[model samples]
Target: MALNIVIMAAGKGTRMKSTAPKVLHKLAGRSLLAHVLGTAEQLQAQRTVVIVGHGAELVEASAPGPGRQFVRQEPQLGTGHAVQHLNGDVPLIRAATARALIEACGGERLALLTIALPDPTGYGRILRQGQRVLGIVEHKDATPEQHALREVYTGMMAAPTAWLKRAVARLKNDNAQREYYLTDIVAMAAADGVPVVASQATDETEVLGVNSPAQLAELERRVQRAQADTLMEAGVRLADPARFDVRGELICGSDVEIDVGCVFEGRVSVGSNVRIGAYCVIANASIADGAVIHPFTHIDGEKLGVQIGAGALIGPFARLRPGAQLGDEVHIGNFVEVKNSTLAKGAKANHLAYLGDATVGERVNYGAGSITANYDGANKHRTVIGNDVHVGSNCVLVAPITLGDGATIGGGSTLAKDAPAAACEDEEALSTTSAARHRSSHARALSCGLRSR
Candidate 1:
């Protein structure tokens, strides 16, 4: 059977009180509509049509990709009107649930997805006679007895395309809200002897819809908790499941332990025996076996990913930007930043340093407060440090320079030229006291006929 999926997403979401379209609001690093479309894609639907109206241009532009068509619904009406020309707002609708709905329809019947909720307020009550579903009554139009019914229509249904087209065309706007009700098609199906059937969703979360910020937040936690549970079941240890979040794909090997308040974004792979401390944010990176990522570290490899080698130790306050590659046993200590740099095995940049556009050799000790001045005004350059090089504290290695094997740079030195192997380079300027320099400057001003204040 040819399947066509229509998603109704034209609501203004006035309750959300935001200018962005309701479907555009993100739940787990992806828009709600994206989640629905992903599920639809799994169905192998022949056509997927998205109804857009509120922030139509923005929504259409921000859509994930091609293959899906968009139809505008100006002056956004009710859910029925939104999908009249072609749907529900359930972001977590699983492919299995949709398949069940389609199976219940069987190309002849009207299959409505329904759920039994503890609090079914604001939902359409499923009117039934024994096991047969008669129709659905909206919350605003139902009687007091109907309001007490816990079983409610979930606004998702599957019907024969021919019958659905005919039913929607006959739908009238004479209800309590003066809007065309998609649920009214239930009564039409019943009257036309189309055998209206109900397919109950087992999981309430799978059918829940987002209408406000609080609802979105609630769903976000639920989705994150589910992901956390899956990771834990796979032998990954999470300090606090509620405090962890994975916005994208996270693949973890055995014995991986992640602490509280950590966020893993994009695609991250953690090898076995990896320990990630609390409050770390990692994205688009790979951590090899036995790596230790300390707390408060931030790593984001946007296009060019970062790689942490085995037994590497990274910061309590370190940052690894795009193109950072650390070799085994490397130590990047507190407040250090590495960007587009490669540090060989046993390289240590401990505390308050920046290594950008640089190649650090094996056993090289990049001193505290040192930085590779890789960027001039126009272009960026690279600094090369050979094996066993020792850089003193507060030194600046200006780019387009190199430190040969076993070379030692003195503290407070700024070197622009390359140093040969086994050489000790140091700045030869005599140190001057601050008071003497101040007095000398004042005297020079007086000699130049400029009065001192």
Candidate 2:
């Protein structure tokens, strides 16, 4: 059977009190319309049409990809006219629920997705006569008794395309709101002797709609909790499920432990026995087996991803930017930052250092307060450190410079040129006795005072 999806996204969302379109508002890092489209894609629908109005241009431009057509609903009349058309508002609708609704339709009847909510205040009430579903009454138009009914329409339905067009054409705007209600088709279908079936949703959260900032926030929390639950069920230990968030796909191996206030985004993969500490934000990165990411670490691999090796120990406070690749047993300590660099096995940058656009060799110890000056005003360069090299504290190895095998750079040295293998390089300084220097400074100060007098 050929399935066509119509998404209504024309509402101005005055309740939201924002400039962006309501459907453009995001939940769990994706827009409401995006969620709907994702489900629609799952159905392999023949055509996906989006009816746009409020921010029509913006919405159309932001539409995920090609193959989706957009139609304008200028001076929007109501749900019926917009869709005359659509279900873009309900972002949480799952593909399975939609598939079930289609199956319930059986290509001959009207199948409306319904759910029983504890608070069905704003939704349309589902009117039923025993096994047969009669119609749906909007909350504003429904009577007191109808309002008390917990079963409500989920604003999602599957029907024969021909029957739906005929039913929509017969819809009249004689109701309280003077807008053509899409739910009115239910009563028409019942009158026409067409079987109106109800397909109950899996849960209330699956059909909840967002209309305000509070609702969006609530949905976000619900989504995060669901992700957390799934991770826990998969044997991942979360210190506080409520405090953790996964904005994108997170694939974890066995025995992974995530602490409170950790956020994983953009397709992160953690290996077995890995531990992520509290308040760490990791995106588009992969942490290998037995790696420990300490608290307050920030790793963001925007395009070129970061790779943390097996058994590596990273930061209580550190950052790993795009293109950072650390080998096995590497240690990146507090306040260290690595970008576009590759550190070989056993390399250790223990404190307050920066390694950008550099290649660090095996067993190298990058000392505290040391940095590779890889960027100049005009261009960027690379620093290469050979095997077993030691970069001393407070030293700067300006690119394009190389420290050869077994090289040792002394503390406080600022080297612009390359250093040869098995050599120790230090910045030369004029030595003076502290007492003599102090006496010379005192005599100069006395002479200056006498001259002034």
Report lDDT (Cα) of residue 230, candidate 1. Answer: 98
Per-residue CA lDDT of candidate 2, range 372-446, in tens? Answer: 988889999999999988877888788999889988776766778788897666653112221122235454433
Q: Over the stretch 215-284, how does candidate 1's per-residue lDDT look in tens digits? A: 9999999999999999999999999999999988899999999999999999999999999999999999
- What are the clashing pairs of model 2? none
lDDT of each: 0.86, 0.87
lDDT of 1: 0.86
Candidate 2: list runs displaced more than 4 Å.
84-86, 428-453
lDDT at 173, model 1: 85
Model 2 scores worst on lDDT over the 10 consecutive residues at 429-438
